[model samples]
Target: MCVPTNAQEADTPTDTPTEAATPTTGYFDDAGNWVPPARDAAPDTDNCPQATWPPEPVSTSERAASTPDALPVTYDGPCGVSAAEGYEVPDDVLASAWLVADLDSGDVVAMKDPHGRYRPASIIKVLLALTVIDELPLDQKVAVSAESAGQEGSAAGIGEGGDYTVEDLLYGLLLSSGNDCAHALAQALGGDEMTLLKINEMAKTLGMTDTRATSYSGLDSAGMSTSAWDMGLAYRAAFDNPTFADMVDTESYEFPGFGDLPSFELWNDNKLYLNDPDGIGGKTGYTDDANHTFVGAVNHEGRRLVAVVLDTTINNDHRAWEQAQMLLHEAYGVSGSVAKLAPANTDEPETTTAAPSPAAGDDAGQEAGTAWNRWWSYAIVAGVLALAVLVTVLSLASTKKRRQRR
Candidate 1:
């Protein structure tokens, strides 16, 4: 015999609602809003007056599973979404940018428009420094040329016609990002032409296929462009040099004066050195064309991340840093690692092993060596000079055409 289970009788209602209904429990809509039944209300039944209270709202968990932040996600290892929250980078912040490889392992991490051409700004000095150090002995004295001393922006307070050791100028160049230092170093190495040649040669050697340099100082010169990836490549190449790395990392320096000049103090322009304890080093740049630009590296935990931001709007340094930190956190999450330098591509003939450190020796031999090295460094300089000329001619031609149209 079949016996009726409680489920069969559960549909029976205990109470019914009157015309002037007092609210009892069950499903009911309160003016379009779902109102859950009070604890004391009776359950809905098949036969009875309609209840006043609405049914319970659906929980997010009961809704679509594809929605983000429905629940805390977990992964077995470090390879997962970034744990650091509250960093939402805007998509349109920088027109062009790129990031790559940990400082240690040389593995490329992430790239945003990596190959896009943009102004290198002061970052160009990384290559210039490499060329200068390779060609000039650190202890050798270089007389400041009129061209170098006359450099317009961010001077190291170096006087024209006075002599400074290669070491002091290198420090001035990296720490202060001085245009004067760059020109002095260029003149000391290969004059203008050879200095630029060495920079271009180094670019070629490093596989910077899209990079072009028009000046050693990275002053606003026409057609002075390089891709973010190319800058990263240049950084990787320069990082191996202990002196170069040390120079960039320095917080402050005191330059000994010459003749009647007083000693001068210089501080690093990179804000990261002061703000971030893990900041290894960085460079900052700004021009009407380049806008606010920065290339910085941070060491988090055991990993190192390098970030390059270009063409950002003015007064957005904080935003730039935020974006960089977010990208680094994401890269760290994805790879469970940070940036590393790429291995030297032996297949490329232009790529040479890092220049050997100069040995302290005879002053004449060193000067001769420096001069000879400069002579060989003219190719990049010529390339940059040509670019400058091209830019000037184009500007003039455009002006003339506009006048004719008017």
Candidate 2:
């Protein structure tokens, strides 16, 4: 899951709570500080004008519905529901936009401003991981460059000039929200520009119409955008990839060391993974501009469900995970489809491919690890077979080995 390195899951309960309790309702002041309403007073839902297509910042406005004609009629309002009459969503939900959907059926159970545009923060790493798993071989080693080693935000501690397996880098990307690991993977995929090109291509393939990635690390960037609906699509697509599924589901791993770096343990920081037995996996993210964003899945009563929360805040009483749990709980027995996730468009031409790793005879000979050299040569020898088939075969075998080991 993606998060700033210094943040802690202090609000996450060691055990899942049996009841969903609403937290205190508050408003942000002129200085962007939270101000609770008067005691026993009605929530000031009318503090500002109604919500519109391009929602106004929550710090300055009330969130009532003004766009009732929006797509997916059931979810066209500020607070949406697909349940029976009198069904009230948890009053404490604080996200500017959120969604809960059935993974298997692609049925959207409930939502609030489902299509509101927002910054994705680090949760966009989900797209990056999916791209890496598809294009690069897991066992292939990448030599970390200084650019990747000194990435700006959270890090997985990969050292410059160190050799790391693609699989391990992926672990760092998801488990630790490592911007450094993300950059290294982006370079291996052909550098920042090409990687963004491929990731946006993948987003289109998966029918994530509202997403446009600007950086592989999911840090705030110009034009980086995603919606709650799009994040739901991302997590749903992720369930089909065994490697992606396995990595997110893993709670802890012994991340390897290289060069002067020492080995350190990495733990899955997705609050759902840590606190709920039913939570399968998820991604987390945060940025000053994006606030806190989360995408998570759960297995409940034989049904698989995914939830997304965007542009939320962390008060003393609740975190993003807690809001997700409340939404998922409200969603379990509900049985109506306000909307459906679009299936991938197969006719879209597949354009994202792994960049050819340089061979030993090339400039890469000095820095390429022995394993990387071997893999590169083997890839050349197996060029007769389609790239898709080779990656599928290797991924299946690797997943089998991982499962068997457990």
Candidate 3:
């Protein structure tokens, strides 16, 4: 062999080399195969250009134009799609109003004409109880007067001259929806009319602008109206009174003295009493004028919800319970489960007071004139009677003058 160059000269290859320099190694390529350079000592050119490996990203607007967006995420509670579908209410049910609020979060889940004013029947007792609890001592004994005992409808039979603790009356008022209890409490607190004044004042102080009470019993009257919003406020205030809430939720209660007379066992008139999930208590009202009214509360999971249904032809307590359940299920993922509401016994006659009768003078005025030609006949009869009386008096005077002349 030709004489080999010195070892140092052989190791340091000449610039005019027989083989090219290799490319530096880098991370693996997209195919996961190590790519070698075409020239042993040069950069690679067979693979994709290094600059073009990461292509420019497409814009969001372009992607959206090519494909539709995905469906919206599911939401629970009164704000969900199910609530938007609306609950089924009877055709005759006029103006069903409701509001479902989370007590802890103060979030209003559902509202249907929340500010619309409608009659509140025995539901007024809730506020009355609040007033009593706030103003008087619970254990204080109030002597039942004729005014309280003689109250017309649904009496607790706390007879005149009898005595009961305020607590007892509160139970009667809430559990039984007793008109007498309301009257007794009103009279105990303030005399006639003043009770209503106090209720109105208290409502105002509570910021219930649309709430008004003309009677403690919630009887039909002019200017007696409350909105769902105002009722919610009232419910919130009432719930603060543990005694008031406990009394309303109680299924039955017996007074101390009334065992011999008709037992004071009271059944809640609110049909939603047991049926509503987490239902605390409620009240109901009905009349020829105010068809049906309800104000009640349900604990929406850990949240407190108050619902008010007014002017419904159907049993509003049931309808309100259903609507509330739907709202809770749809908006907050609460299960719309319900317990059976206790039914009233058919044997027990539904007790209601007759509407107050008009005064005798008012009745007489209404019946004064008949269409059978009676008006002229009555006028003629009156004129003849007057003439007869005048002639009799003149004849007596003439006899007196003759006697004097003689």
Best by lDDT: 2
**What Cα-based lDDT does every candidate model obtain?**
0.59, 0.70, 0.54
* Estimated TM-score for each candidate: 0.59, 0.67, 0.56
Ranking by TM-score: 2, 1, 3
For every candidate in turn, the CA RMSD to the true structure comes to 29.0, 22.2, 35.1
Say which candidate scores most in TM-score.
2
Better structure of 1 and 3 per TM-score = 1
Local distance difference test, candidate 3: 0.54
Compared to the true structure, candidate 3 yields what TM-score? 0.56
lDDT of 3 at 41: 19
What candidate 2 gets wrong by more than 4 Å, as runs, is 1-87, 343-406
In candidate 3, what residue range of length 10 has the lowest lDDT sum?
5-14
Better of 1 and 2 by lDDT: 2
Mind giving the per-residue lDDT tens digits that candidate 2 earns over 1-406? 2222222122112221222322244333333333322222112222212232323332211122232232221123343333333335776667777888888887777766565667787889998999999999999999898889988767888888776899999999998888889999999999999999999999888777567776678765555677887788888889868899889899998988877677879889888878988888888886645667788888988898888988766553667788788888777778775666654344322111112345537765546666687899889878856787989999999999999999
